[model samples]
Target chain A: MDTAQVFGALNIIGLFVFAVSGALTALRNDMDIFGVAMIAFVTGVGGGTIRDVLLGSFPVWWIAAPSAVFICLAGAVAATLAQPLIASRLKTLIWADAMGLSVFAVLGAQAALAAEAPAVIAIFMGAVTATFGGVVRDVLLNEPPLILKQDIYATAALIGAGVYVGLMALGLGISPSAVVAALVTFAIRAVAIIFNIPSPKFARPRKTEL
Target chain B: MDTAQVFGALNIIGLFVFAVSGALTALRNDMDIFGVAMIAFVTGVGGGTIRDVLLGSFPVWWIAAPSAVFICLAGAVAATLAQPLIASRLKTLIWADAMGLSVFAVLGAQAALAAEAPAVIAIFMGAVTATFGGVVRDVLLNEPPLILKQDIYATAALIGAGVYVGLMALGLGISPSAVVAALVTFAIRAVAIIFNIPSPKFARPRKTEL
Candidate 1:
């Protein structure tokens, strides 16, 4: 497949996986079925929607493409049906989330580049796209955002986006660059998960006086 | 002043109060100075930004209007400086938040109507605009969202938006309709707060079998 076609396919996978992750979270929180679908839909599209708005892409990608909405609903249903068989929902969620994060990071940067944003903004958009969906889901569920508290999550997306942008700038082919970047991001996340690393923090003490 | 000019003035007040509320939350969470500013800025413009994006208004409102950014930062600074003097931060925040929510609910509905959205969508947008900023703030701080948990918050916005739309449909003038709607919203919220009313809940038992 050509670069655009391959990226399009990966994007679908990312959306589906993100939806499942969101649905799982909603189920864990005891939300109703409609709430599950709504959370899944937002988690599937939240990051890219934010990026598109910032980049001045009007109507967003999903408004014109109703299939994306169906895909999210389907993911939510699948997650709900499979809940009983899943041996470890938390582990499944983490791995599925890692995949979604990696794919969206590259695609988000690519989109920003297409929109002619500066390199730095494109990189920022990449991380935004990769993380904001989960952020929205967590926010709605009243949970601490994994992006803020987890080890090497947004950082992995940033590095992945940087890798894609840097490679493209050096005249690398889009498909290979995208593949390499996504894999690198997943690897970083996997390592973090396996080793149970904590996200880095500044040394400044919390101000109790405020 | 004309309706548009009056609404513009109220919009600035809404933004400022929302920023102060966000800054106070960040301060309570013990976030650093920059974190305070970031949360304040997002809480100031996030709802309108989302509205503009969904309505296909390119670049969102704040990108073209840099003054909003400065206003939010000023609010953050003002809140930080005034922290010691404010005898009851929680009370101040609730009142400030009520003002922001009232103004934005009317404005959001008006914007959606201007964008030619259906009446139902416009009302939904009103609630989204009035509540989403606080939702974002609470999410970042890992707190339960006030909109979902507080009494009559989103309900007040929805009713206010409906009133605005209904009045305009009945040939009421913009300024009077807007003022009436905002006042009604604030009154509902005030009553709920004063009486310590709880949000309505469905009688459905929690689904533990998921």
Candidate 2:
């Protein structure tokens, strides 16, 4: 497939995975079905939409295609319906979420470039598009953003987008470049999760320090 | 004053008001001092900064000037120290917030216009900038966004921005148009609050509905 086709397919997959991530978080947070769906939609698409607007691509993704909305709704409903059984498998969901995050980082930069964004902007947009929605979701749920807390989330996106843009600048064909970028990101995040890579530790405060 | 100057003044007043509004909300929620300060800072300036970045203004407000951060911190400290006494006088804080919201709408539109945004985009930015941060604060605290539930919040911003843009398009001076817009918005909101204006009632479920 060509670059456009590769990016499009990956983007859809990222959206679905992103929705699943949001639904999982919502489930853990004890949100209702509607609440889960709303969180899912926002988590899956909010960052990309923000990036697009910043880049002046209006009508936004969900507005441009109702299918994304429909799919996100279905995912949330499925999560709610499966909660009784699925809660036992949160480990699996986290890995899936990491994969989703990686895909989004790669796809985001590609989309920005296709939309004619500058290279540095494309990389930043990629990271923001991949990760900030989860931050929003976490903040709304009263959790510190995923970026601030745990394993290599925003950094993974940043590196992945940077690599993709760098490769493109080096005149590599877009499809191979995208595949390498997505795979590298996915490997990094998936290995981190699967092998239980520890996040950088915050300094421990003594009880009397405060 | 030019459009930029009008927005600059409104921004200063808005900084104080929004900080107070956020700190007061945090106080009512019984957050600790640090939590209160954080909420105050984010709610005071977060929305407009987000709007500005999405509109391609870099460094955002807090990053551009450290003073805005100090103002929010001071507001938080003031609210924290005074909450025991101020709790009984909640309406005062509410009125102050309403005033801030009105001015934020005017300033939001003016900022967008100064950035040379299209009129329609400016109006949208006005609504988003005035209403989004509070919405973020409410959602983070797990409350329904005020615009989704109560008085005419986003609607008021839209109306004011529309009026301002209309006047300015007719070659009216910026400050005069902005002042008129802000005054009209503040009056509408103040009157509505005094009269206890509400959104249209949701259809109540009958005895058999459940």
Candidate 3:
């Protein structure tokens, strides 16, 4: 298979994991079937949708390829069926989610670079692609988004995307650069998960007029 | 001078109103100055950005016209300065927000029609353009989105966009249709606000296995 196809496969895997994470959230909230499906679809495709829209790519990725939609649906259904096991194994789910985040961040940067976006924009797109799905899901669930929570998630995406672009500019081939970037991202996230990295939050003002 | 410019001016007014609404929300939450600015910016432009991206319109509107950005910033600053008066005059703010909703809904439909989208997509884009900005602001503030709360807000945008598209399809001129549609939307939203309309919510599932 071509390099693009290989990356596409990786992304689909990431999409499935994200969908599962969304479904699990819905289940935790005791949402109805429609809510479960809606959350699944949004979490799986939300970041990519945002990325495509920002890039001005037409029809969005899932609308262009319905199989992606089906995959997300299937993932949600599977999570529903395996809820007991999933709830008990939250740690495993986080690891899988980290892997998905790594793949998505690299792919997002690659898509932006292909579109001839500036490096800074490409990196921002990468972080958006890796994180915005969860943000949307969290907002819908009335939880503070994971991006804003004390976590090292979004920063890892930025670093990975930056590394990939930098490697490409240094004359690395596409395949090698992408693989290395994804691995580096996964490593950073994995370390954060293991050591429990805390996000730096902006402090609230001490005084209120009211 | 032209039809588009006239509509563009109307949209800027709408943007200003949305920014003010966002700033008010930030003040109500006792957020800091940075939070107030961020909320104002998102509330003014988030909906239109989503619409443009979905329509495959590149560069985003504000990127193309820095004046819109300036308008939102100015509105936010003004709202911050006028917070005490704003907090006291909640009723007036609701009226202003309804006016913005009307104008944005019509403008969104007009933009979609100009892009040669199908009527259904055009109407959907209009509602999205009017409502999603508020959704983004609420999400950022960790509140239940007003769209999800008991209100006729989204319904007003849908009705307005539908009226505009239907009028245009019947060979009415753009200016007349947009103006009439905006008035219709404003009237519906005004009625809802005065009457305290409630939304029909989906019932939550009965039991959770976990």
Candidate 4:
């Protein structure tokens, strides 16, 4: 398959996984079926929507291609039905989410390039596209945003996007570049997950006595 | 002043108020200055950005008009410095917020119309413009979205947007239509704030014994 085909297939998979994660979060929060679907749609598509908006891509990707919407809805329903099994395998879920993030980061950069965005903006778009959906989900669930909580998540996305953009600039084939980028992201995130690597935290200021 | 001039002046005030609200929320959450500025910018411009993106307007309004950005940043700084006084004057804050909502709804609809969006789409855009900023603010602050909660806030926006659209369809001049619509929104929200009106909520479903 060509780069476009490969990216298309991986993007669909990423969307499904992200949707499932969103549904799972919604279910954990005791949301009803509609809420589950809403969260799933938001989590699966929110990042891309933000990226597209910033790039001035109108109608948004999902609206132009309803297949993504269908996939997300299906994934949410499947997740709702299999919540017990999925929730029990926390490690498996995290791995799947990492894979989704990796794929999304590469795809986001490609989309930005297509939009003729600058390299920095493209990288930023990639990171936002990869992770902002989860941020939206966490926000709706009234949880601290995982990105801001220092899981090394956004950093992973930034590195992945940077790698992809840099390789493309060097005249590397898109497919190979994307593959390398995705692998780098997934590997870094997996290592972080396994090692429980804590991101650096700021020291809290001491309270002064009046 | 013409309708455009009036809208321009009110829009700046709306942006400032919205930015102040966002900055105050960030301050309460103990975020740093950057976070305060980020939140303020998002809350001030997020709604219009969403609307413009959906309509396929390029570069976004804030990017095209740096004045908005400057206003929001200044508002955030001012809010940060005046936190104590602003926080103490809760009633005044609410009144300002109501005014912002009123102006945003009308302006949002006008923007949609300028983009040649269909009437229904314009109305929806208006509501999104009026309320999505607060949604962004609440989400960032890890609070349940106020629009989805009580107080009839979204309802007020919808009514105002609808009234404006309906008036325009009836061949009412833009300025008069906007004035009537803004008044309607402000009146409804003000009454709700004064009377402590509670939006109807659905009763929780009984848990079935498995």
Model 1 Cα lDDT, one tens digit per residue, B4-118: 7989887898899999999999999999999999999999998898788788987789998999999999989999999999998888888888999999999999998897777
The TM-scores, one per candidate, come to 0.61, 0.56, 0.61, 0.61
lDDT of 1 at B108: 95
Docking class of 4: incorrect
DockQ-based class of model 2: incorrect
For candidate 1, the TM-score is 0.61
What are the candidates' individual DockQ scores? Answer: 0.16, 0.06, 0.13, 0.13
- Output DockQ, candidate 2: 0.06
A133, model 3: CA deviation in Å? 3.8
Docking class of 1: incorrect
Q: Residue A6's C-alpha lDDT in candidate 1?
A: 84
Query: Model 2, residue B65: displacement in angstroms?
Result: 2.0
Candidate 4 on A64-172: residue-level lDDT in tens?
7988888999989888778676547456557667888999999999998887777866776788789888888887787687555435677788789999999999999
Pairs in steric clash, model 1: none
Give stretches of model 2 more than 4 Å off: A1-45, A50-109, A112-210, B1-5, B87-90, B200-210
User: Over the stretch A103-145, how does candidate 2's per-residue lDDT look in tens digits?
Assistant: 8888789889998989998999889888876776676556557
Give the better candidate number (1 or 2) by lDDT.
1
